[model samples]
Each structure stands twice: as C-alpha cells, then as structure tokens.
Target: MDFRPLAHFTAQDTWLNDPNGLIVRDGRWHLFFQNNPHGPDWGNMSWGHATSPDLLTWTRHPVAIAHEGPEAIFSGSAVEQDGRVAAVYTSAYADGRQAQSLAWSEDGFTFVKDPANPVLDRGSTGFRDPKVFRYGDSWRMVSVEADERTLLVHASTDLRSWTEVGRFRDEPGTGIWECPDLFPLRLDGEELWVLVLSVQDADGSRVVHRVGSFDGSVFTGGPPRLLDAGQDFYAPATWTGAPAGRRVLLGWMAQPTYAGATPTSPWRGAMTAPRDLSLARVDGSPVVVQKFSPEVTAAFSREVADLPPAALVRCGFDGDASWEFRAGPDVLRLAVEDGSLVVDRRASGLVDFHPQFARVDRLPLPAGTTGFSVLLDRCSVEVLAGPLAVTQLVFPREPFDELRTGGSASARVFAR
Candidate 1:
C-alpha cells in the first residue's frame, strides 16, 4: 500500500490537500484548495481548482490564484451573483498585510481580481475566511473575530459596502476559533440546522467543532458538536446544497503539533474524503456524520479482496506498510511492538499511546468490526481504519514495528 494523500469528491491524485471554496455554479461543482505549488510545504500557499459534474470524477484546473497576490489568499466561499461566480477569500498580501479580498469569474478558471479589491477591510485585528451567502433579498458574511466571544457575522445588501450585523456568543470552552462557516439545513421534516467550526491551537491535542441552528437573526443550540471523534480532523468547511438544495463537507487533517516547526517533508497534509453532511439527532441531541464518499465503494471494487467477513487481526509494519481491512460489527484495537503487532476488539473506543515510536490508533464504531487495514511509510501513516482515511507524518521512536493478532475473528491488512 502506497500511503499518500487522498482527494475528496474523486480520488485520482494521492497528495491532494484542503477542500476550499466548494461551490455549485451553473449546475456544476467548483472546489478550490489551500495548495503549495512547489510540493507539500505550507509556505507556498495557493488556491488549486477542480470541477465535477456529478461529484464523482474531478478535472484539475490551473492554480486558481497563482501566488497569494497582495495578501496570502487563505480560504473562503463562492456564490453565483449577477450572472457571474464570485469568491471571497482571506488574504495576507506580500508586503505584510492581511484582509478579505473578493474576485469574480465568467468561467470557473480565469478569475479577475475585483478592482474594488479589499471591499470590506475594517482595521480590526485581521479578517480571514469570509463565508458569503444569500438569505432572502440580502447577503451575509461570517468571519472569525480575534475574540472567541464574537464569530463576526456581517450583512451586506450589495457586494461593495458592508455593515456589522452581530456576533455568535462565545461560550465556556473556545481557544481561538478560525474558519467560521454557517448555513441552514432541514432535519427529518420539521427542524433546521446551522453549523460552524473554529480551528484552535494545533499544538494542542484536539480541534473544536460547533453545530447549531438559525431563526433569522442569530443561532442557538447546545454546546458545539464534536465533528471528529478523533484527534487529527481540523479546519473543516461545509457547503450546503450547491447551486441552492443535503449539505456536504470536507476537512483538513494534520498533526497540528507537527506544523510550521517541523523541517517539512515530501508531503504536507490532506483533506479527509468529502462527506455528505446533514444535521441529525444522535443520543437525543444533534450531531453531524460526514457521509462516506461514494468512491470508497469503487475502490473496494478494484480491491484484491475484502478480508471477507472483515475480521480482527494483529497487524505489523516492518519498515513501513500499506493495506485496509473492512470493519466488522464489533469494536477493535491495534498495537505495534518492536517488530510485531496485535489486533483485538475488547478495547475499542479508547486510544492510548507510548511516547516512543510505538503507536496505537483505534477507530471506533458503536457496532462495527474492529477490522481495518494499515498503509505505512518510513515516516508517514495513512489509515483507512474506520471511516474515510487518516493520513499523517509520524516520527516514530523506533525503526520497526511488530504486529500481533488477537480476537475471535481475524482482521485484514493488504499490501501493494
């Protein structure tokens, strides 16, 4: 198994990163990303574009905005306006400045920088990742405020002038909320849902996710929902019913702790498989499960085998490894030793690790086989463990890992 990055919507490329500006225009889908033209380093941030007609196959286009023009173009949303497609992105120019910049395109590829660049730059701290949407006869934009208390949601009747509407209250636990996005959804048949995410200090152990609902002016709900039960999922963006209709989402996965400071490598980070999203009730309250990409099944079709009756098996990584095991209805656990591995289902739902190179990753499901596969590289890891996939660069303490197998049924591991 060659452990490389995964692309959302489609999977032709192995090293695709963040899913940026996922918008639907003229009955087609446009996806822009935070990309590094040179390779997988974060320093060369640029927007990469892709288009799809059925959300399955994708055609890669040119670098959306070559180098971050005046300010580094971070990420944001796009909407169809006045018969053209418009994009609003967070930019920190080359001269050492940051603000929100907007652009429009007659076609998805060639974007003309709006002459009215920096349309709404209030000399606040710094405005980034502007999520623009159309509601009623007016348009609304929500951005992350310096203070966690206020996730600035602004209103604009026309694309030029803007006014501050209000801020979503910052509650008990919020570190530094980045990338604020909000949209409405219909649940079951009666209720509606609104969701938002604030990327926190990557150096910290986990990321933050919050989902709520709107009643015209503001939004209210319980504490923010944890989008990813795992430690790696972060900086998630949601696109609600493209062209206007179930929301779908894409998330960036990273070892926040490994960013910036690390010497960097052959690859940087990647976006989780695109998920069909919807606000629903789990445990009597509301939670969101990004649906698996339909492409997962296609990959399975071409798979050598399914590890039929996907069992639990102790797996090992010699120098580095690759392969996936279909999960069973039971929970599972995996442990890597000096040169061996162990697989069992009793200790599912929980994850414990050793400080050294030895590592443990437990992808849990309330009722699914603990069976899974592993894709390992000398210094990287891509696990198709439970859900879509989790890819990362791991500086393991040791040079080799031994896999041990346990449990009633055997788990599966495939090697390319």
Candidate 2:
C-alpha cells in the first residue's frame, strides 16, 4: 500500500521524527526536524532543513547538522539572535550521554555548529530535547529528564552560559517525558502559560499539556490533560514568529509502535499541517484550541462540494452531524452525539500490525462548535474540532474515494 501524504509536510527521501526549530524569519517559515538522511529507519539522526514562503509548499535543503564523532544530533529549538539564527539541540553520544549544544546560521539555509559544543551538561542520564526561548533579557530553556519524569529549566544570559532555575515534575505515569515546551497564552483577558509535554515508552507516545502561570524562573500549573486524543500524535512544537501573534504548532504524525514498520519506502514519518493555537472557554474553563492555519487554508483555492478521497476538507454544522469515509473494505465513521465528538475507526483497515491501533476515540465538544476541518491524506486523517484534534493513521485496502455527511453539515474539499 502507498502511504504518501498529499497535503502534509514530509521529507522526500528520509525518516522524520520530532519537529525541531519551527520559526519564521526573513519572510519565510523555517522547519527543522529530526531526520535520518541515509535511510528511512531512523539512525544517523541529524537536523533536516526546509523553508517555505508559505507553510504549504516546502523546499528541502541539505542536512544542517551531521553526526559528530560519537554523537548524533537530536531534537531542539531555534531562535534569531543578533542577526543570525541559532539552534539549541541535544547531542546524544554513542556511550549514552546527552548534552545541550549550539549551532548558528548566518542565512536560514546554512548552519555551523559551535566549536564549544555540548554547552551544558546536567550529569544526568536522561537529559535531552532542549527548547530555548527568549525571556526578558535572558534566554530560558526547558529540557526533559526522561528517567525522572521531570523537566529541568535553565536560564542563560548569552545562550552560552547557563544556570539551573528549577524543575517541573509530573505525577507518576507509565511513560517517560521527552519534549517539554512552555509558552504563555492570553485567555479571558488574562495571560496563562501552557506547558507542553510528550511522554513516550514501549507502549507509544502521547502529548499532555498543563495550563498555569510561569514567572521568569518557575512554572506552577494545574493537572496535566490530554492534548491530542489520537494514537499518532507526538513531539509537537510551537512557533510564535508567525504573522500576527498566532501560536502555530506542528506535530509528528506517526506512532512509536509502528515507527519503522510502515509500508512507505524511503520515508517513515511526516508532520501534521500547521495549526493555529489559542485558548477558548469551554464550560467556563479554558481549553487549548487548534484550528488550521490561515495560510494553510488560503493555500487551497479550488474547492469542491464533496470530499474527494484525499483532500483538505473544511466542515461546518449547526446542530448535529455525522460523516463516513469508505474505500473497499475500510470504513471510518465520525459523528456528534449528545454534544460529544466520536471517531470510530475499528474497521478503518490495517489494524493487524499493532494491538492498540484499532479503537474508538471520543472528545467532549463545546455547546456551539459549528465548524471544523479534516485533512485527509492517502493513509491518514486529521480532524480539528474547536479545542480538540484527532489524528489517526489507516491503511485502506484501496484508497478511500467516498464521503458522506448528515444533518446540517457541509464539506468543502480542497486539493493541491
């Protein structure tokens, strides 16, 4: 079965994992990712570079950071510092030591690693995935200690020297926390910081977020809640340098269970299209809101009346709605019942590969969620309701070519 995505961002001939260094600079959007250039199985990890005028069509560049003597370049964040773009990443040594390192790019395309690499080491076993941002006059960073399920926060005045401020630990869970990101969102005329964390283990990986307050040093928040209720979402990163003050996000759209088991050749993972994030009140509580980026929506000019197998479809409804997609022996159903959004993909196809791939996922929607969008690729479907987004991967026996909707819903399908 062919699994190439039609509208999503993917490396043409390599494996991609976490989205690294998503930033907009110099009138272009820069996307760096965890990539293995030699093959599709995820080794020789390096930072793959790409840029786009808009977020839709991407132009791939050469590998930004190659493997050093005993270390592979891991995930990190990028920022513009003093007329150049700087990338702060983790160097995972062959002997199992991980440390934060730095690289610089005069232009967005070419990058040079700092000679004084591995700038910071906490002397811990699971420290990696550093996300750096500007806070006041200093730069603040958050990296995960996977073994301890904690996030270590650090502050640096020049991005070279650092000091540990505090650590954010979560309740005991089955997985190890990996990517940790902290950013503020304005809601109800108040600013609230959102802590984004990704937990991964043998089972798979899932993203959870906490909404709270963060001073210059410490972050205190409420309990963590599910960010995306799907089996294929992980390692999400947000960028604030977009047009307006939009907090745009992108996530890896593959699960760890079948990371290297997909039928696709040369490439193994792809990223979810960019989503504009906000905070909305649902039942008197603020929830994370995700919608398609305006630039992404504007990229699709030709709109048809019905879904055409693989298309970017915008959907809206007044009351209740239901939709079904089918291709040969595969069928997936989506509906709204009693103010709850349901996705039943039990018979969606290719469930025999993993035990946890076939299941029904549900999300409670607000009272008046009148519109949403579904981005249907060749083998994946990403549905974005108001404050909930569901991403699932399915392998139909044949390509799904039919779509049906009920109630007052209408589908506007767009293809590139």
Instruction: Using lDDT, give the best candidate's number.
Output: 2
Whole-model alpha-carbon lDDT for candidate 2:
0.85
Give the Cα error of residue 58 in candidate 1, in Å: 3.5
Residues 200-311 of candidate 2: C-alpha lDDT, one tens digit per residue:
8775678988888899778988777778888889999998487778799999998877878866777789998888889987776777988888887777667876556568
Candidate 1 lDDT by residue in tens digits, 1-416:
22232333322332335567778766667788777767645655677888877564578788887665456667777877777778888776765555777788888778887888888776655567788888779888888764444677778887767787777765555456677777766667855655566456524544444556665457676776556644446677776345436567767765455443322245555555555656556556655545444443333333332332212222333322323221222233344333223333222211233221123444333223243344433333334433323444433233213333433334343322
For every model shown, what is its TM-score relative to the native structure?
0.72, 0.94
- Model 1 Cα displacement at 38 (Å)? 3.8
Return the clash pairs for model 2, or none: none
RMSD of each: 7.7, 2.0
